[model samples]
Target: MKKITIQEIAKLSGVSVSTVSRVINNSPSVSAAKRKKIQAIIDEHNYTPSVFARGMVNKQTKNIGVILPDISNPYFISLITQIQKFALDYMFSTILFNTMLAEPNNKNSKHPLTEEDYLKIILEKQVDGLLILGGEIDKEVVSKDYINALNQLNREIPVVVIGSKIPELNCLFIERNLKKGITTLVSHLTALDHKNIGFIGGEAGVKITSYRLESFKAAMASYNHSVNEDWIVLSDYYTADGYAAMTKLLENNTTLPTALVAINDNVAIGAIRAINDAKLSCPEDIAIVSCDQFMNGDYQTPRLTSMDQHNEYLGKMALLQLISAINGQVEPMIINHNPELIIRESCGSKL
Candidate 1:
C-alpha cells in the first residue's frame, strides 16, 4: 500500500502543500477553514506521521524508556499499569527493560551490566526520556561506580526515579513514606496490647529494605519495646522466603510475639499461612499487620490491617512530574508522600 503524504492530503483537500503543512504543524498563519479541510482529509486517510519526521520537528522521539529491576513484583506491576495509562493519555509511548535484578543470577558473570549498557539503550532506542525504578532507586548503599554511572545518565536525558531517591541527581524523585507506614503498623500493634511484637523485614542489601528495617526499629523503640534480633527475620520479598522467615522465628525458643509486622502484604499473607500451619489463629493467638494494603487483602478470610501507600496515585504523580521535566518546565524535586493505615479485622479493631 502507498503511504499517505502531505501532498496527497493537500490534493484531496483542494489546498496547497504549504497550507497542509501549516495545518499539520499548527502554524498561526493557516486559516481555520483551510486547516479543518486539510485535517479532515488527513483524518479520513488515517495518516500516521513517521516518528523520524516527528523527531525532526519536535526534537523528541515520543518514547519513554522504563528500566525496572523486577517487573513481577505486585507493587511494580501496579506501578507499571498506572505509568502506562498516564503515558497513553499524554500521547507518549514507552519501552520496557526488565533487569530482573533480584533473580539470584551470578554477579560474577562476564556480561555484567555497567552504566554503558543503560547509555547504549537510550541511544539505540532513541527514547526521549527515561524512568528508572526499583534497584537503583532503592540503593541504600550505593558504590562509587554506581553513583558515577547514574551521573553520566543524568547529564544526557530527562530522567525520573519512582518510589525512591538518588543523591546529587537532577532527576524527579517520588517516594512513599515507608517509615510512616511501618510506624502506623507498630501503633496498631501497640493499641492491641501487643508489647512483644516481632517484625519480618526485607533483605538487608537494598536501600528500601534497610530504610523500612531502621524505621521499624525506631517505631518499636518509641513504644519502649526493643526488637529482639532473634525475633526479627530478614528475607527476600517472596512468599516462600516470608514463610521461611516466619518459620525460623517460630523455631526459636523465645515466646512468639503477640503480633507480627510484615514488610509488605505479600510477606504478611505468607506469614498468615505459616501461622495457620502452626494451628494458631490470627488476632486470637497473634495479630497480623502488613503494608501495601493490596485490594485482595480486604477479601482475605480475616481482612488484613495494612498500610495503603496509594501506589496508583504515586505512579500518576511520577508520570506527571516526568512529563514536566521532559518539557523543561520544572527542575526535578523530591515528592515525599505519606502512607495511611487501614484498619481491618486482622488487627481485631472494629473501629
Candidate 2:
C-alpha cells in the first residue's frame, strides 16, 4: 500500500502543500473552508504527515514540556485540560512530568516526583520550552540551588512558571494573587454574619500556606474578628491532610466557628466531608467557602461557593507569553490574575 504524503494530498486537492500542512497542524493561518477541503482529501487518501519531515521543516518538535508537582489534584488537572484545549487549537502537543516534590513520608506531599528527574527528561527530549506549574515555584523564596538549576536550563530553552516562584533568570511568569483568593473567601464568610470563623490552610511553611494564612488572618482581623489559633488548621495541600487538619480543629475544644474558609477546593471539600460525618450541614450548622473551583465542585450536594482564579484564561495567557519568549519578541514577564468570588449554596444566603 502506498502511503500518501502532504504533497500528494495537496496535489490532489489543487492547493499548496503549506495549506495542507496548516490544515493538518490546525494552524489559524488556513481558512476554514480550505482546512475542511484539505482534511476531506487527506481522509479520502489516508494521508499522514511525516513527523520527522515536519520537525525538520519547522525546526520545532511541536512539543511542550509541563513540569507539575501533582497531576492528581483537581486544580492541576483542570489546568492541564485547559492547556490541552488551547494547545491543540494551535497544533501543539504536550509532554507531562510529575516532579514529585512532595515527600513520601510527608502527609502533604501531592507530588512524589523529583526535580532532577524531570530536568533530565526535559533536557533529553530537547523540548521546545518548559511550562513549570508547581514545586519550588510555589515557594515565597526559591533556594539558590534551584534558581541556579533553572537559570542554567533557561540559557538553552525558554521557561514559563505558572503559580511558582519567580526565578532570577528571565522567564515568563503566570500566577494568581493567592492571598486575594483567601481574602475573598474569608470576606464572604464574614459577610454572612458569622463572627466565629475557622481557617484551614496548607502546610505552615510552604509559600502558598504562608501567603493564604496571612491573608486569612488579615481579612479576619480587618473585620474585627479575632481568629482563635485553635480554629486554624494548617496541613499539606491534599484532601487527606485537610481532613486531618479539620479533625484537629474539631478536637481542639475551642468554640466552633459559624463558618469555615478553606485553602483550596480540595481542602474545602475534605472539610465538607468531615462536617457531614459529624452530622452537620453546611450553612445550616456551619457555612463554608473555598478557592480553585473545578467542575466537580458544581455537582456537590450543596455545590461549592468558590473563588474563581480564571484558570483557563491563565493557561491561554501562559501559552502566549511562552511563545513570545521563545521567539525572542520580548523578555520574561509576570502576569498576575485577581481572584473573584463565585456565590453558591455552600456559603450562607446573602443576609
Candidate 3:
C-alpha cells in the first residue's frame, strides 16, 4: 500500500513530469486532450500531490496571503471577494488574515498583529505572494520596525499593498487617487453652493485621513472658501464613530456646516442617522458626501452620493500585478486608479 507520486502519474499518463506538474498546478500551458489524459491517470491512481513536495519541486505553493484591517467594512469585503475570484481564475489559493486587533485604538490589545507579524506567518507558510490591504501600511508615518519587517518580506516574495504606500520600500502599490477623489467630492458640494462643509470619520494622523482632509482644504480654497476647524471632526472609520462625531459637531458648534464630507459610506450613513436624531434634514439642513461608494449606499435613506474607489477593479489589478511579479514578468510598480463620482440624492444634486 504505497502512495503514488507525481513521477508515477507522469509515467502512466505518458507525459513529462513538468507537464504533470503543470496539470497539477492547473497551468493553461497543457492542451485539453493531454490534460484530460493526465487527469484520468491521476484519478485512476487517486494521486494527490503533497504541498511540501510540490513546493520543493517548483519553489511555489500556489498560495497567496491576503491581509486586511477590517472584514466588516463593505469596501474591504468587496476587495477580498474580487481578489479571491481572480486568484481562483488563475488556479491559486488565498489565505486571508483579518488584522482588526492591530487597529490604532485597541487599548487592551495583547498581541497587536502588525504587518511584520502577518508577513512572518505568511512567509512561514511559504505563500507565493502577499497582498496587504491596510494597518500600519496606511499610516502617514510608518514605524521603523514595520518598514524593516516589510523590507525583509519583500526580499523573499512579491508584496502588494492595496490603497496604501510605503515609502523607501520596494513593494508594489495599487491605490486609488485619494486626492483627486476628495477634491471631486468637495467640488461637487461647492458647485451646489455648499460653503461650510465639515469632514467626518477617519482618525487623525492616518495617511488616508490626511490625504482626504488636505484635498478637501485645497478644494475649498480653490473655490475661495475657508475650512472651519471647529466643524472638522476626526474619528475612527466606523458608523458609530461617524454618529458620535456628527453629534459632537451639533452639540459643540454654534453654527453647523451646510454640508459634510464623510470618509466613507459607513460614516455618511451614521451621520445621516445623527442628523435624523437631531430632527435635522439632509441636503436641507446639511448635505452629505462619502468617499467609498458601496452597495449599501444605494439603499440608504437619502441614497449616498460618493466617490467610487473601484474596490473590485483595484483588487483585480493588485492580484494581476502580484501574479506578474511572482512570475518575474514585471517589476515592482505603483498603479493609481481614478475614482469616479456617483451623484445620488445625499449630495442634493438635481441630476
Q: Which candidate number maximizes lDDT?
A: 3
Question: Residue 62 in candidate 2 has what lDDT?
Answer: 76
Give the per-residue lDDT digits (tens) of candidate 1, residues 9-85: 87888988777777765789988888887788888888876756766667887889888877878878878888899
- Model 2, 1-351: lDDT tens digits are 888877788888889988888888778998778788888988887777776688779787778888887788777887888887887776678898876644443457565544654676697898888888777767676767677778788787888888654537566677667787877777677667787888885876577778778888899899998988888888876777767877777777557888888878888778878878878788798888886776677788788898888888888888877777766765656566877888888897752
lDDT digits (tens) for residues 128-202 of candidate 3 = 999988878888888888888888998999988886655688788886688998889888888998888998889
Task: Candidate 2: give the clashing pairs.
Answer: 100-112, 100-113, 137-164, 137-165, 203-235, 283-286
Regions of model 2 farther than 4 Å from truth: 1-51, 101-113, 164-167, 333-336
lDDT at 191, model 2? 65
lDDT of candidate 2?
0.78
Q: What are the candidates' C-alpha RMSDs?
A: 3.6, 4.3, 3.4
**C-alpha displacement of 275 in model 3, angstroms?**
0.7
Q: Write down the TM-score for model 2.
A: 0.82
TM-score of each: 0.83, 0.82, 0.86
Report how far off residue 314 is in candidate 3 (Å). Answer: 0.6
